[model samples]
Target: MSSVGGGEECTVTEQQLLPPPPVPRTKMGCSWLFSLRTLAAGFSLILAVLFFHPSLHSFLVGSTDPNNPFLYVRNFHVWTRRHPQKAQDLSMGSRSALAATHFQSKQTYIIIHGFLGSSTDGWILSLKDALLNREDCNVISVNWSAGSTTAEYFLIQPRVRTVGAEVGQFLSFLEDTAGLYTYQVHVIGHSLGAHAAGFVGKTLNGTLPRITGLDPAGLSFHQADSADRLHHSDAVFVDVIHTHGCYTFLKMWEDCFGIDENLGDADFWPNGGERQPACEDGGDGATSVKDGSSCDHGMAYVLYIESIKYMPSSTHFLARQCPSWKHYNNRSCPCGHPVQYMGFNADPRAHGVFYLNTSRTAPYGLLDSDCSAGAFSLVQIIGLMMLSILLVLLLLLVGLVLIQQYFGLPILARVRARLYMEDLVWHGLGKSPSTHILNSDKAVDT
Candidate 1:
């Protein structure tokens, strides 16, 4: 009886040790579902924070004060030939004195730098140097760094109009106080600054002389109206360089730069307007600046700077008028009369789109000399050599056939007879009749 009780106790203990029957699958599934739900919620929370952060920051710290110089006109500085290094600050109210002193009636070049750029950008300064070196003109480098230096493109985009209005006001002041005229003014701008230049031109009483837009920023301005963005009607003559204009898949940053549409009277599309030579690589457009991989966006200013530098050079930077890049590459487009040049030398009279090829490096201008002439010449030489060789081969073949037909058969028959006689003599076998007769005579003599 005691042994039976011990067995029962052991059985109970083993049953306990053997784990309770597996939990129901439904219960286990519910636990897993709960865990997944928690994870999803956490992920959603993170996404929400990321999405709202910029807006929240803008709402909290954005400037509201009307008198703030950084937000308005005080930040725009004018750099001329006389004061290349030192910038003359022209506010809305107090520009008459500065204009009288520095403004000239000659051609006035107002250069406005793009987003995250200042009057001191290398390209701007280089352009100023180039312009001053060539002609006696007033090259004013508009410094709106305070408005342009923001990381948020949206924040800075709206401020462009304010900067442009200030530029217009300054131009008006120059016109009233100094001897400056609207016709003498030439506004050159890059990216966002291009639109600002357009605004400046629009605000003037009459159209300005010209406006050269270097890869005008497409972001907010791409779909914007003529009054808001750069347009051909903004100036008497508007010229645009479209460097990085095509929409790139998976590259949202690139889409925000460079206007793809034809906003100017003459639009120059160099190398099909996207992925410039030597700049076909990786670059996050916002973070990686000036590393040349952004060459597609930066090439416009680079070409412009070179154009200004080499303006006086004899080589005419020729371009072919093409309906599209396909025609340009296919060589279907002819170099027509009333030749047009790209960049600063671009003829105002030249209407419609122009296409051209450029070297990847500096001195980007290509000479009017035909690019395909060398290739064509090489092909011609090769063709001529091939034709000469083919002719020679044909002549040799004809000569051999002629020799076979005229003389080879007779020679072959003579050689075969001589061989037969030699064989007969050597083998002491059957001989020709003449040889046999001769042998017979020899035997008789013997």
Candidate 2:
């Protein structure tokens, strides 16, 4: 209180001097403290949390296990039926789906067909067979609104949720039932089917998804609008087979809205982006995606499965393991030994040739954003710690502004705010908690 020379005294309420008590101190049975010592302890806890549970609580939350990616995933199936109503939801009848079920390596496939397509469309069988023949994959040729409409149109129409839902179920089967933990799963879709593949890859829950859209359906009504929903924009192995652009290289390159714009990868385009008038113009009205016989939309999968040989990295394109199983500079198998491709055929369509070439390997982890497990997880945990610490500090400083509002010891509340209640309580109750105080002056005698 201040006294005026004119004989008037100014009185100040204790309320204005302190802030509110912290919640940690108010809990009925919980102990709270407000002192420099407690702050030191709280700081120590932050370090301990980071050091102890680095995998779960630290930044490594979604980290990948390089030695064994299969640890958390289950095997993925190729062809399976969903609830009947599920098909109708997307205005699509369950065109029969067929996928080869075999896993020689960690590779898996989720293949899709185009509009008005059935399991029999271009290279459908060959693609499945080729992928299955590999020691790595279990290929699934998903059937979703095969011919109903352009993905741009149907993806937005409320009914597409049916396809989305079924795709979600398929992914669940891999995670929950199949135990597809450690291996890599690749997705392949042609045209609208390609979009569906994108959706499946985008919607996958736990493990990151790898996708290869074979001549992705034209238009962005769906891909761009529902980007985060399905397409990661940066997904790995997102290939687009431009057999549709064979003849009119310029046209294919110019069609920004359809075949040309979304090839997803540069090297895999028609003619390797080189012009081939003979193949494109051989048939009348040929070299256009809509033209059926000119090897437009129909032949993409055909060439993919039947002809195109791959560079070692192209295994990602077919959602299959490279026959040789060698990755990155022909590194030997983990046992410090090399795996042989007895029937390694470089000819992609030769089925069992020695050497061949096609698409390039996808940028690592492009398909699944979380595939960089260790790095991503580390970042996540660090972020969480920062958030937790920031909250603790906020509570302490803010609590000081309103300390007198509660009946508890105000200074004790401030100290407790600096210490995360979890760490404090876990360490056990304080000694002589009954001596806790309100202010620096009040604590001196305690």
Leading candidate by lDDT: 1
Sum up the clashes in candidate 2. 50
Residue 351 of model 1 has an lDDT of 80
Clashes found in each candidate (C-alpha, N, C closer than 3 A): 0, 50
Give the winner by TM-score. Answer: 1
**Tens digits of lDDT, candidate 1, 1-446:** 13574565323455566767876679889899999999999999987775566533333344333544333444455666787667666654455556544656788899888887767676777787788887888878786654443578887888778778778977887788676888888999988899989889888843898999999887766567888888899888999998887754466474536877889998998888765663544322223235222557888877777776555234445677899999999989876444666788887877889888876554567775663322234556788899999999999867766777887544444446668667888877656687787567657745
User: lDDT per residue, candidate 2, 139-254, as tens digits?
Assistant: 55554422432334443333333344455565554555446643366666666566666555555542443455565555433335645233434244344555443324455333
lDDT of 2: 0.42
Q: What 10-residue stretch in candidate 1 is worst by lDDT?
A: 284-293
TM-score of each: 0.63, 0.39
- Model 1, C-alpha of 242: deviation from truth (Å): 0.8
What is the lDDT of every predicted structure here? Answer: 0.73, 0.42
Q: How large an RMSD does model 1 have?
A: 28.9
